[model samples]
Target: MVSARSVAVRARSGNVTRRLLTGLAAAALASATALTPSTAHATPPAHSAAVPAHALTGYWQNFNNGATVQKLKDVDDAYDIIAVAFADATGQPGAVTFSLDPAVGYASADDFKADIKAKQAAGKSVVVSVGGEKGTVSVNDEASAKNFADSINKLMDEYGFNGVDIDLENGLNSTYMAQALKAVHAAHSDVVVTMAPQTVDMQSPQNEYFKTALAIKDFLTVVNMQYYNSGSMNGCDGKVYAQGSVDFLTGLACIQLEGGLDPSQVGIGVPASSRAAGGGYVAPSVVNAALDCLTQGSNCGSFKPSKTYPGLRGAMTWSTNWDASNGNEFAGQVGSHVHALP
Candidate 1:
């Protein structure tokens, strides 16, 4: 999922060797632990009625990534939420633009819109993701924020996207982003807003990305925290979780669960296959175990939740193209499990 970004050598779950921690890093984690918010009794935020139950979300890159190129219509049935990979930010601040990759021959606008309508008819959500690993979009001012909302709205009008995703990997401004989201929601009352933040981005209650989630929680549909590509991070239980272990998924997810997000608004995101990410790929069984542990309190690791979240939203993967390459194992295996959730 970290295409075009610098990748670090990391320990996989099977060969994880412990490393000595510096005093400063230890101290920082302790401070963050103490400051994290509690959501044991927090209520779910009101959201658009368009939100799906236990969604199997996937990203469909406009360009092919080793797999056969797929149009918005070519997405598999296992996916209920399809996020169109990127809408480019123009040279003008906050202005965004999108075009189907020409390498994959283009279809007529009518054909594209017709396919999107069919997906919606069969109960699928289509959205445009705003940034990627190399994304340069930023909203630093009020005018820029307004431009962000306007451009997204225009894309929604043209392509029939149910909403937009905040996948801005470089940086985000909580104030301006919340403003942009509110403006878009105001224009389209049923816009479905989703977020795909990195592991470190949502570890604490006070992180800017966390603040942005809180700022727009009322209308936020889901926050699919990417659980791969991170080395090791502190879970809510004050223990470090290494990538690829069940503990890593369940523990980090607890931070979001207890940090004021509704169970239905939280989802576990992972690479669909070993080739989909550099160092964080896990089997579909591993993803299922994490989901069961979070929602059913079974198949748990060292850090089990005090209570279960049967209402928890389902899983997401980096891209559908990778799942296709893997013979759709991710969607077939995990999608069945997600649909069976209580």
Candidate 2:
């Protein structure tokens, strides 16, 4: 699911610190490990208690990505869920670890943990995001599935993170990933879980990303599909629509809304500014309009939904740092709009 724009952006920036694990290596390593009971835990019924009725999600970059370098305390109040950019892959298959980038200026892990605690005290969820444009950690087999769950649960315990976000850009194994998530929940019952799949991932329910979303829909918090970096795609109506337009937002969102996902589980993910992504940089007004169109049937482009979904979850941005770099317009405007949704 890596987009051309994302590749170009990363290449031009030359920030290659993010690790890459190929599918073959991941598979081989996963097959070699022994499966444990913890990893084989069955998924319980879906239920999440942390997310707000209509929430605003923003990714806080752990590394310096030319966006504003922000500490956890600096994230905008409008954001109810602040996802830490990524958790790093370890030598062991499916194992991940996190370290604060010195570039972000955290004096110590304790300082960072305190910030996380403060955010939680304010009723905001701080989650660790796994996988980004360069993320390729795979959890295909049972052993790796257990490893993934144990590692993430360890991170949650160590960092006091509220949850985890699945942003695997290369590929996903829904069965094992679902197993891993259920195991994670088994360890932390009130955990908040979210996904940030690319556009094509949600175009059809048969897609692996969509299947994973459906497999864990009961407890899944939200699916904020990246609406940028994607070229033209088919809307729910089967019409091709280009990106950076309200039609693209509303039309594509319809597929998830109508395709058996609860309206509360569907959200629009976009860049905070033009610089945040290579393409699909819509104005905050368009984001608000898309929200309005989906929830109220007003402010719609040519592609209107057959019905309005007042319970439609909300919106998400690539990085809160980008929003801060851009005068916080996305959070100030779109965040306000999302909170006001009926």
Candidate 1 on 1-342: residue-level lDDT in tens? 233211311111000000112343333223221122111112222222355678888988777556556777777888878888788879889878887777555667677778778888887888888887877789877888878887887888777888888888778898888877766665554678889988888988798788888887766888988888878889988999898999999999999999988887899999877777776788999999999999999999888988888878889987787788888899999999988888
Report the Cα lDDT for residue 49, model 1.
Answer: 33
Question: lDDT for every model?
Answer: 0.76, 0.82
The residue-level lDDT of candidate 1 at 14 comes to 5
Error of 1 at 305 (Å): 1.4
Give each model's clash number: 0, 3
Top TM-score model: 2
Native-structure RMSD, model 1: 11.6
List where candidate 1 sits over 4 angstroms from the true fold. 1-49
